[model samples]
Target: MKNNKIFLIGLLAMVFLTACNEDVLEYKPEGLLSQADVSTTENLEGLVIAAYAGIANDEMVGPITHQWVYGSVRADDAYKGGGGIGDVDVINRYEMYNLTIPDYGDWMTPKTWVNHYKAISRANFALELINEASEADFPKKTLRQAELRFLRAHSHFMLKLLFKKVPYIVETMTAEEKANATNDMTNDELWNMIADDFLFAYNNLPQSQDEVGRADRSAAAAYLAKLRLYQAYEQNDTHQVTSINPARLQEVIDYADDVTGALEPDFGNNFLDGFDNGSESIWAAQFSINDGTLVSRVSFVTGLNSPNSTELYGCCGFHLASQNMVNAFKTDTNGLPLLDTFNDVDIFDSVDGNGKAPLAPGITLDPRIDHTVGIPGRPFKYRNTVNEAGDMIYNFSWARDPGVYGYFGNMKEQQAPDCSCYVKEGPFVGTSKNVDFIRYADVLLWKAEALIQLNQVSQGIAIINRIRDRAANSTNRPINAGATDVYAIGTYPLTLSKEDALKALKFERRLEFAMEGARFFDLVRWGQAAQVLNGYVAVEKTKRDFLANAQFTAGRDEYYPIPQREIDVTGGLYTQNPGY
Candidate 1:
């Protein structure tokens, strides 16, 4: 069955050809229309769907290999799995850190690159076909084009974030165009193209998308803000400390503020299954488990589960939250990261197998700990069940040997248990939950970060406090006030000097966005990757037995070696990042 799935994916690639030689399709059907037949507006929508499909593709945003692996795994939030060749390679070795190239054959690297461009191509094709269709109405055409532009810009932005110098291909370039293509643009030129694409999307897209999954003007604006922020980081890059462009940072402040009004009052609701279209979600990848369609099964791959759940092949447990990540939640007496003492906390105590006092002095921890980590003795959001023996069982654990399992996994956004049955044999599992691409709280935090950087510390605190207020005061049934423990632990008497305020914002972002794939990039942008990662290496060597056996460095290991294969292909046309 696994071979069959791979074959299907291969066949699908042939059906929807891209300018690039590689194919992005993960599955193919037994029968399908020819490429020429699929060139019309109605037919092209399927292709457009295929493009969106890439975001949810296992290699990209989908469950098995979300960008989170690169974003969080390389940072402190997660450790690589413990077994197998690839498993040890990713987790233990520092050399393969940002493994996003075709040569490494990480599956995710090529899939991510191909998927984004595939989606962009579909959007481009959609715009072209719709423009020629006589029956298309002006409003529909305009909206569809706006949606396409947003998607194109979104994909390009993602590529730029990962590979700082990807070729900027706006229109669908032909094979001849590809032959002449070169990584000729300077960093500024590439960023300008990104900015232009996003601005076009912001100007043309609707404030809100009619569909639950499509991008809106606000999403485009948010991307623009992020792009500008990144570009500001690249202004006269000296690597040691690049100054943030004030003009560009101010633009980020304005654009982020424009979307701040769309925030939902309840922060948790923004992640609920039915709330994919909630006020806070500017954009999300849509999935559904109905009709046995494997298209909607991303959650099954990303959700926390044991190694041997029968519903899915024994491919669970990739992104295990680390002890350092868990420690980040503990606050100091002054309500700030116990910066001086965070490393002093004993994280292993939260689990029974490890020794030391429980994170706090109890069998359980503050409620937010319960909400975030799936330590023993804690109930997950949706996995509470009673067995025939009448003992409550939290099904978050792996079904190891079927009847003998009784452990918990992260249950914050669990889909039905049956959702995993869709894969039954392969590394994939089908889940119907919508994956949020952008949420209002994130935008709020981004704005807050920008404001702080711009010297508006008080305003930044107000924005962050708004998010905290919702988590603390939500009247929704069984609100866990302990989630606010961090606020009290870290924010009272918030006395911070300008530099301290910036550092606080960084810590706040780390805590708030843990396990969400934002930490690594955050470290990079702050110019603190070398410091934090080196600290992690030293501490891991002294404290963690498993990591003690590894070797790593700070300056050389900070940026990933541009996949060796990419260098070979570019043949000196592209320069590798320094120290790679």
Candidate 2:
């Protein structure tokens, strides 16, 4: 009996020892990585890569980078143009400026806050890791840190533009410090701090990077110029324009002088699929399709703006160009744009009472109108084709609801369905088209704005004419040019008054970057939002009933509110912006 009991005890001990073996206990979980795992030079490069990855993500919040919904629709350039307001109800409310604190669009506000901070957090982590490693340990330590700082500044700039108040976070902050971070910095301090990161990047980064998408000195210079341009236009707490600093304007020109990229000979070159990351592109987010992945690494941020349920494009149409925007393309007999009188006559006006017919056959229009907008009877860029009777014309039957929204479809943001860059995911069509965050033309325009502000009106006129020359000479006309309507565009007159030059600069920017999302910011910077947007609503309400009673309050509508969720998470460390 004693021997049998001893045998049972020995058997149990053997089982327990096998289960508790070191090999079994110390095994790492599948696909999990630790700090030590990524402590090498190549691995640190990968970490910076991860930080860059944050900007090119699929989240609407993070890089909500595409400004079609927020910039274009909210401004006068576009309509909330999906099936109806209900297609994305939040967008409708945003367009109307009737957003509530707990409205659905407010959800995007918090998400944007979270995403920008998430990107900043990644940058902070990379900086910390880089700090621990020596130059001998990491050969590209300085460049990597510069790149990360540029990214961090980029994220912060986006936040600053969207939300007037944000908590700035950096690597040195302890968890408690981060939790206690507040938004009490003065406007000048905030702009200067953000500019410091770009200045550091501009000093440290190379002229060009071996990797395609990496930040270079030119990119840093361009972004710094943009930052300085915004800084030059100072605003009060109530969002009224207090002053435009002449010193800061000179700074914009100085920084813009550093950008050496040339304008593409053809303006259309900036929009096509194959022309991405061209010489004109100072910095662009990279995308890839057919890189051996099941799904393409493309941005669908503008996917919803594609025409609804058509063979040319497969989904919702959300960024329909406003009739007002379309009319802004109208040119007078001498081939100059109608800066003041464009809105008096709608593009759809016809001899008969009905306004539904195609545009008048011989009416002269700016050539850029063909590239930036899709008219009903004209050729639709690369998608021009022959239908049943074999007459070539791009159809607008795909427009979700032309009665509610105008008939003009956004053209620059989409690609031809037949292009290699095009991809379909369920009902939406996405493309690998790189969004040109900053272009050389942007540098020119920024410099022009600065020059004009400094009373160098004639010099600014030359720059403005330089841009108009490119638009006038652009050769991206329809395949059957003889069959298309009349196209006319010309440069500004050599001599112009200071007032006329500024108006020319403003109108030129509207045309150059129509759907690319610079409209609202321009209006805000020029201290014309109340005058321009209020007048816009007064007229637009007659066209779009949805905008009835839509008001742009001077103090309240300048910036969106700080997210309520962020306030809750920080336990009230952050204060809400005025008027929510």
Candidate 3:
């Protein structure tokens, strides 16, 4: 019997006969169309949609769009919380920086390189085809070109951060030209090349787009600020920051000023499903479910990170909050973070097997903790609303393997299991929620960073305090406000010294953006990866034995080794990054 409700994905394929190779259709092979047939204006615009789809192709482990593994698990923010050490061995190796492994055939490394290049190829193809069309045929030719360039630059920026040195591919390059391309650009030159794309995008893109998902001038401005912030830390071939570029820091401030209302009034709004594209959002990858489509465009990339069998969410659990992260939320008697001694006490000390850990009476924590992480006895997201029957609980029995991975659940990525947005695809669970690639809070933090590096330490402290003040007042808490847990957060001291101000800024970012996949990258840019991570390993090893022998080498651990498959494809044209 044929099922009428079952839809086929074959109807949505996009076929392109490229001048370089007819085999290019392997990536997206649905509709049959020739490149020569792409001369019409409508066909040119369709190419842009195809380019946008590339970012959504992220599933499981995309080094481009999803950073759960690379940025969070690889840092101190999260642990590889699956079944056990042998569950996903490659990821476990990555968590330990076990690069000495001879076999680099893991699926993530090559898949990351391939998926990003696939997006680049589409943008390059679109650009060439758009050029062939007349301005009369496509009146918005410049705008389309600008959009495609932004996509291309975005892909390159993702690659640069993950691989450090990647070939700069453009539409001007032929198939033969690209095959012979190499990752030979100097660090400074590579950054400038990426900056050029964002600069072009900033000048040509409109202030707002008619489409909800399109990148606008403000998005371009925000991206340029991010790029400039990274560029301001001038690094040498060895991946060490040689000097700080003052002019580049100034550019960050200049570009940040051009961005409007990038910071939302409430931090909770940024994590909700519907308010994803709000004014505070600089840019986000769009997702839709039940929108007359066969399947959702939802991000299944972090599917493995959901909670285990429970009433709230039934599935695997791959990314759990580290004890270090939980401890970092502890505040002093003055309602401020005990930055130096926060790690002295463990949050799990009072917990029993049922995952019930009651804080001492009058104990206070930042309200953001409930929004960012799911701890036992605490509400998950706003799941504890007044009208609901009960709260969405994070039960210790819900953990896949609590003996190894802790009982903490990731709240930011998962919706209530009973919510319409949650989709149960077999044993795994996913959600039709938009993923923010860059938000306004990120821009504000970047601005604060620039101010600190420019010697305006007081101004930087003020900006950091503003974020703290927001977190202190953020209302994303359990609806049934009880006296069990305290919510106390204080602003930074205005008379802070430069050294103290720097420490405060770093701590604030950790508390503000925990588990959102920005921790490792922040440490790297600050040139503190070695010191910070080594210290983390020392303390955490006493908690988890898998990390007892883990170490982070200064020169080697800064960037992941380029996939051996990519190097093989280049036929020795590409040189391996240092200490690979």
The top-ranked prediction according to lDDT is 3
Native-vs-model 3 lDDT? 0.77
How displaced is residue 481 in candidate 1, in Å? 14
Off by over 4 Å in 1: 1-39, 60-65, 82-88, 91-108, 127-139, 172-174, 235-240, 260-267, 291-315, 333-336, 348-359, 362-366, 382-428, 474-495, 549-559, 564-574
**Candidates 2 and 3, the one with greater TM-score:** 3
What is the TM-score of candidate 3?
Answer: 0.93
In the range 256-323, model 3's lDDT, one tens digit per residue, is 88886556677787787667678887777766666555665566888898878555555678899998
Off by over 4 Å in 3: 1-31, 101-105, 385-391, 479-481
Residue runs of model 2 more than 4 Å from their true location after superposition = 1-31, 60-63, 102-105, 349-357, 387-392, 479-484
Compared with the true structure, all predictions reach lDDT values of 0.54, 0.76, 0.77
84: Cα error in model 2, Å: 1.0
* Candidate 2 C-alpha lDDT tens digits along 1-580: 1111110112211221222111111211122346776567766776687667666654533335777766788899999888877877777877887754743455666666666676676677778888889999998999999999999898898888877777777787776787688888878888998998999999999888766678889899999999999988998887778999999999899989998698999888898887776789898776777654456567788878787646556678888888899889888888889999999989853222332235666567877887888666666664456543233344557578877885678888877776788888887877877777888999999999999889998889899889888888875556223343667888777578888889999999999999998888888778888788888899989988878878987777777777776677668887777777
Return the candidate ranking by TM-score, descending: 3, 2, 1
- Which of candidates 1 and 3 reaches a greater lDDT? 3
Q: Among these predicted structures, which one has the highest TM-score? A: 3
